[model samples]
Target: MRTLVVYESMFGNTAAVAAAIARALGSTDAVRLELADDRPAIGDAELVIVGSPTHGFALPSRLSRRAARAQGADASATARAGVREWLGGLAAVRADSAPFAATFDVRQAPGAVGAPSHRVRRRLDGLGFRTIGEPASFRVGPTAGPLLDGELDRAAAWAEGLRGLAR
Candidate 1:
């Protein structure tokens, strides 16, 4: 199946998780990994997985992106548009059989103040994608994180589970 994995990152933790997910789902061939701010094309995606660093208890706004970049955009790239803006600009497409979708978020902690996945899931649903399961989250130990140990493995495992659902 063709999977589209889109992500927005500040310190690159979220991008790392997105990459792990795509790798688990066969990144080299089937998965198309992209940065969300680039407004990645959702074309021909059997499964669409999106993720970002939860900011201010919701999706990142332009202000938040700017703030994050100030802290450190990391090597991958800072999100200029953010997932919120990208989703907002995206045209809703209703397929004959709604395609599967999932969302994940990176946060300060599991029960931290932010959770962007739910809102992202809702937006994707609005765009006519069938949700695969509950949104997922990966935790970071600090604000600028080298993601907590094992998070990458966890992300890969989560993607493997999603792959089963896609089948």
Candidate 2:
């Protein structure tokens, strides 16, 4: 099935996760990887997967920050707006009948902290995605992640599982 893995990355950890997901989909021809700004066409694809690295509790980094700051938005507002804009771009093509999923990648912290996955999942659900599964996270290092053992394999496996949800 056709699939698109769209993602936002800060220190490249998230990009690695996106790549792993795309690889597990096993569709060299049908899968595509895109920076969130490229606004990939998901119309023909049977699945659309959106991912981002967590920043400031529930925000996405880099482009989302710039997009928000340019408009003088706060962290929370920026995140909400960014996700909305990203999904809005797909609205013209994404079939209301088709299914979609969302996930996030976060750095491994030493103690308990907030996770942005639930917020992302809620946003995707609001956009009418089927909410196929719980959001997933890949551990990252303080700088340039040593990726906490097994995260990449876990991401690939998660992607493989997600494939079953495709319609």
Candidate 3:
């Protein structure tokens, strides 16, 4: 199946997780990995995965992005709107042929509240996309981090599990 993985990263941790997930699902030829800033078309996607870093108990706001950038986040990281803005197109989804979607978010730690995955899942579901599973979260070490050791491996495993739902 053709899969699309869209991610918004403030400190690059979310980008790494998105790349790992796309790689796990298949080769680049079969999986399209895009940054939320790119505002990629959801065209022909059989499986769509969206991920972003959690902020203020939900998706990052413009103010949050600005704050992150001020705190040593790369300028490129906040160059444009992130996941919250990109997901606005959810309204364009056609119920008759919407794809299956799953959401993920990078958090400060495990069991942390305010993960954006919940809101993302709600949006996708309201827009008529069939959700194959609950949203997933990956932990990051400090605020700006190297993903807490084996998080990438765990992300890949989580992505591999999503493939089963496509069948």
Candidate 4:
């Protein structure tokens, strides 16, 4: 099955998670990992997996926020446009009834940090992708991450499960 893994990373933690997922998918010939800016075409792939590191308030990174802002004149417009764009992207893909999976890599912080995965999963569902499971988070250190032990393995297993769903 052709699979595409698209992700955004603030540091390298999210990138590491993306790479591990791609590796677990096994063989580069079958799975491709691309940065979100690369704008990869997933039209031929059987599965498309998207990931992002949870940032402020469990939202996407500042870059994404900036893009959202540029697309709109105000915070409300930014929110609407961001949601629309995200949904539209999913819709374009889902028009073909293709399956998709998503995960969020977030720092484990105390108290009520926003869970970006909730928003991501909702958007994916809105696009008509059958959600096979919940999103996963990987811990980050003060600088970035070597990742908390076992996080990479957990991410791999998640990717493996996603692969199974695609098949």
lDDT of 3 by residue, 85-155 (tens): 98985565788888889999999967847779988988888888888876899998888997888999999
Rank the candidate models, highest lDDT first: 3, 1, 2, 4
lDDT per model, in order? 0.85, 0.65, 0.86, 0.64
Compared with the true structure, model 1 gives a TM-score of: 0.92
Backbone clash numbers for all candidates listed: 0, 0, 1, 0
Which candidate comes out best when scored by lDDT? 3
Tens-place lDDT digits, model 2, residues 50-165:
77766566556555566535644343323323343575565532445655665665556643255666676776677676667667877876544668879999998888887766
TM-score for each predicted model, relative to the true structure: 0.92, 0.75, 0.94, 0.74
**Residue-by-residue lDDT tens digits, candidate 1, 92-158:** 7777856789999999867734588988898888888888877988989878898889999999989
- Identify the superior model by TM-score, candidate 2 or candidate 4: 2
Off by over 4 Å in 3: none
- Candidate 4: TM-score? 0.74
Model 1 collision count: 0
In model 1, what are the clashing residue pairs, if there are any? none
Better of 1 and 2 by lDDT: 1
Write down the TM-score for model 3: 0.94
RMSD of each: 1.9, 5.9, 1.5, 6.6
Instruction: Quote the positional error of residue 79 for candidate 2 in Å.
Output: 14
